[model samples]
Target: MKMTRFLATGVSVALVLAIPNIVTAKPEVQGQVDFFGGDGVLRSAEFDARIDNSGAAEGRMIFIDPSAAAESDPDGPGEAVAGAQGLLIDADFDCLVVTNNRAVMSGVIVDSNTPERIGRRILVTVEDNGRGRRSPPRRLTWGIYPNQARNWTPTDGELGFDPGAGTSWLASDAEREDDVPVPSNRSEAVSCDSFPPGSHTLVDIGRDDGNIRVRP
Candidate 1:
């Protein structure tokens, strides 16, 4: 009887220990951003992502591209900025990774304005740089606006701001009045898919301003 009781207790303890190992902790990453684009065809873009560990991501992204000349006549009948167009992309985020205060998200373009872009892959990263810089740019220039150029020109795939740390740039009245797009500096790369999805690689694309939280 004593032996049986001891065996039963041991089995119960073993099951409890195994439960933790069997039940893996899944992480969640979700966030949204509304910012400008420095280069590329993107004039400005916004992303909203709500993704869970089950590989289901619900979000959408919209970007504007103004190929027309500046000062397209605000009172014009057509688009305020001539030749400017907005593109939409419905994304499905299946992978996410977070480190420190930054988050990297990866997904596929389930739908897009460009029909041929459907089913393409997409990845992005965002960092909460607190509020922003205390002193904003009085004016925004395509190259370096003397805001915080890091004294170095961004390479082809380098971030607009310093990768290690820096506050995000907010558009000043000068830039806004100038009709420049949201992102003026080359603060971020195009994507974070270079590393394996879900890796703790934080590549902050220079977002204008928004909020993003990662529970991972």
Candidate 2:
């Protein structure tokens, strides 16, 4: 009876440790996205996540809104160019699916500068191409005019169009005028070869090499 008890205890402890490994054995993705200097308004995001089937994520997802520079006055003091409007969304991730070259993740916003954005959901996709320029550098790199172009680098210097992965997002649902439903019951440890079908908005490209990653 003592031997049986010892065996059961050992098995229980082993299972306990193994369960955590299983949970974390899934996919993990993290990266920064800057869609500014491109077309449209400045809509960028950053995230790091690895969630389970519960669909409730414990990570980070911050989105920035474009707020053209605080218009400057030729005769008045210069205005601050805080690129993005004060729009950052602290969120929890619940899903992370990876394809052969891309990783897709989703999360729900907990707080934000805008009240209507609270409780909304957003999804991001990162494409891994073995590290390279996301897009060729343009005059946007020199900060000259609104040419509707963007690059990974801010100048034509050595870092001009630095190497990094490409990241995109789908915020149509999250950008609604009002709060949206939270996400749940998403699968973990998935794989694919092509990006999921949809109109995803690229965040210009990663500003550096630590944009994002995915296994297989």
Per TM-score, the best of the predicted structures is: 2
TM-score of each: 0.40, 0.45
Candidate 2 lDDT tens digits, 124-198: 566655554564321111111111223333334556474433333334365676764433322232212123523
Evaluate model 1: give its lDDT: 0.48
lDDT of each: 0.48, 0.51
**Which stretches of model 1 miss by more than 4 angstroms?**
1-26, 39-86, 131-193, 196-208
Q: Candidate 1: lDDT of 42?
A: 35
User: How many angstroms is residue 144 displaced in model 1 relative to the true structure, after the best TM-score fit?
Assistant: 25
Q: Per-residue lDDT for 30-126 in model 1, tens only?
A: 4444434444433444555554446554555543445423323436655444322445556655545556555566556676555544565666665
Once fitted onto the true fold, the runs of candidate 2 whose alpha carbons sit more than 4 angstroms away are 1-24, 40-44, 52-58, 68-86, 132-210
